[model samples]
Target: MWGTSRWVRRMAQGLVLIASAGLAGAALAGPTLTIGAIVPQSWPSTAEGEELVLGMQLAIKTWPGQPAPTLVIKDSACDPRKAENAARELVAAKVDLVLGSWCAIGIAPRVVAEAGLPFVSANAERLPKAPDGVLQLGRIELYIVEKLAADLRAATGLRVGGRTSCWMNFEPVLREQYDAVLCPVLGFDKKRWEQAEATFTAAHRRPFTASVARGYAAMEAGLAQLRRIRGGKSASNDPIMTIFGPLPPTDVPAQADAMQLVLSPKLPKLSPRDQAAVTQLLQTKACTCLADNSCSKPGPWADQPFVVRGNVPKCPTLAAASPR
Candidate 1:
């Protein structure tokens, strides 16, 4: 009877030891990092926001790190109030880092910074000046507009009017008035962009946009910084400061057909000289300055412009009367 009791006790002790060992192994494995994302999931910028989230997810999946990070997404709905609330929620949840607040740049960055967290803005109309920890990944809207205007004027000698907002609603009308319309596109490696587009399309059954590319790049930049921090290679205490350094310019020769140009149906026939001028305008490179203020340099797709023509079904009534 005593032998039976001893055997049972030994079995219980062995089970406890096994469980303890399993827990110790888990402890050594460590928890995956949590990244907070605040993006619009409602009206206004819903499509762009969804693409941004998809891009971030793709970045996380493709990371070659030992333990991949996870995302905790909160919908900003493109509203300032909602974005502020979302920032608070992310802070409360103790996310290691924050990325986004696309349209709500006014409020979200401040809120996240106040909570002592790093904020990376993927898309903003203008760079936020007040927030100390904020880092912008995308180019400034006004700068792109100005660059396009200057390039067009220099190349075609045409007057260019700048519009900051309502691009989708007013583009058709604007295109009718203007000779050409230029927009900013994230400059990514051609092969890499193609691969990313394929992956995105395969998963979502639709094509991605500039917003998606921005989100992916922002996530990638953030992850790269995180890796540096983990490896004790980060130079600055602020991750934003460390990662905002100027990137080296690429030596890849510009491809002639790399520019995205769509000729407008309403466009009048151009002379050979005019056509050459337009081509020259399309090949002009734009400079993107780093957030660190270290350098102003063109990206890999510097010479490749993103030009879109007005998709108006019919030319304006006055267009017929006007001479080229």
Candidate 2:
């Protein structure tokens, strides 16, 4: 009876060793660290929020040298409450870093950061004084609004350009929260811009005019239309010739308008087309910024192309700037 018991004990010990070895091998084969992504899968205009997942995937593809982090994606659908719940789950999962809520669900990364985890946020431009481990990316709305004015003026030769701006205070604040780069460029006093916006708003509508604010596009398009109807020769009628304004009023489009540029709610990172748009605006004999003398010395905002490179669309303004 003693001999039989000893044999059974030896067998059990061997089995345990094998199991432990197998588990170690599996751990070695799997990702050493995990990254959680909280994003909106649906609701609240899925178009902009959908890029949250894609951007992280792109980041992963770019980070081969770094210890490849395992990505776990959770959908918060741009909801604040659900995002908090998702944050708790990720914390429980013991993720090393988090990327999420590309569209201003401020609580998601705050939870991660509070947990002392590393996080990268593509949005929530108003995210204030995050913990040391957090980094926010992109530009803001004032720059876009300001650039819109510049681009329109440069393109159309209209001194005042157009106003399709949603002039409410929260609207600009919301725009600022999404972008950081525009912090340097946004005018300190937007009162005149606001007054212009009011004048424009009273006249037309803006686009994407949703729960947050009115659209700047409605007034923009209306100004274009009215200018054309009036048969005025100032380039504002041509839109393509002007560097318009901070923003005008807008009406939502029949089809959702394609995002013309990426914003940070704070700064402007001119997209290639936007750069070209601004550059072309400069070429239109309407670029007042260039006349400021500082611009003549190849300052910033130079090297912006007016046409999408490798595609030659007819921009008479650019042709005019190109020396014959």
Candidate 3:
């Protein structure tokens, strides 16, 4: 009876040790996801760079369990060569995924695809097909084209054929399908785009434009994908599909015909306060200095009042817009 009792005690101890070891292993096996980003950190797009970083940082912090990703960011300076080099560095760092440039994205795709890394572009105008390993998260082509076409018909009651408009900015293949009247331009509905831009700028207190908004939207899309990644699955496992849902629309100011103007529905929504701010901003007259002057040089628009001609002060616009 004594021997049997001693043996039973030894067995219990062994089980306890085994269980402790298993727990320790599980604790040490925490997931570590690494993500890399490339942006124009130098002159021309510095505000954009800051906004992009803020968006990604916000997304990561709000994720549950504080599953922080190791972020490696590089400056593209809005240059294709610089973007390519930055991508190569990210690939070398062995990041699981990549978020890339607003300006240089057109050229950066080839580098990302060669590295077999999954990527999201913050401001790509054109969409990409599968197996390309890249996704355009904001300001996508199809949505903009359709919306522009609809707006034109409403404005002119006729489609402008073979006309060099905003449609000209799109690829030849895409433009061919829209041989109608008055294709939308980049700021197709300038009045509406300005309103949306002002609203977003006021809300964020940063210089917001369509491209910057696209950068923010791209980060949101990336965060959504990161949330869906199952544990231990390869990050390369899925293709980034376009989220085709409409975000809440920002209202365009009243027009001659009361035609409702809005930014592309492809964009994500801004808050209610932001929408109101945009409405207020649209009431003000355009500032000649803000519109024509370059912010690249100091004191260009420094003396201008914050509330220009009854419009609430938002961030000033860039001198010359960067070409993506």
CA lDDT of every candidate: 0.58, 0.42, 0.49
> Candidate 3 residues 75-187, lDDT tens each?
88778788888888888988877887565555676677688776877553444342355655433342343554454344333332322322212211213333232222231
- Tens digits of lDDT, candidate 1, 64-160: 8747888998988777788888889999999878887565565787888888777777652445254655656544442455665666556565545
lDDT of 2 by residue, 169-242 (tens): 11222233232111111121244334434443454453212211111221222223323323444234122211
Candidate order by TM-score, highest to lowest? 1, 3, 2
Task: After superposing candidate 2 on the true structure, give the runs of residues whose Cα lies further than 4 Å from its correct spot.
Answer: 1-31, 47-50, 65-67, 124-126, 139-324
Please count the clashing residue pairs in each candidate, in the order shown.
Answer: 0, 65, 6
TM-score of model 3 vs. true structure: 0.48
Top lDDT prediction, candidate number = 1
Candidate 3 stretches greater than 4 Å from native: 1-30, 128-130, 142-216, 227-324
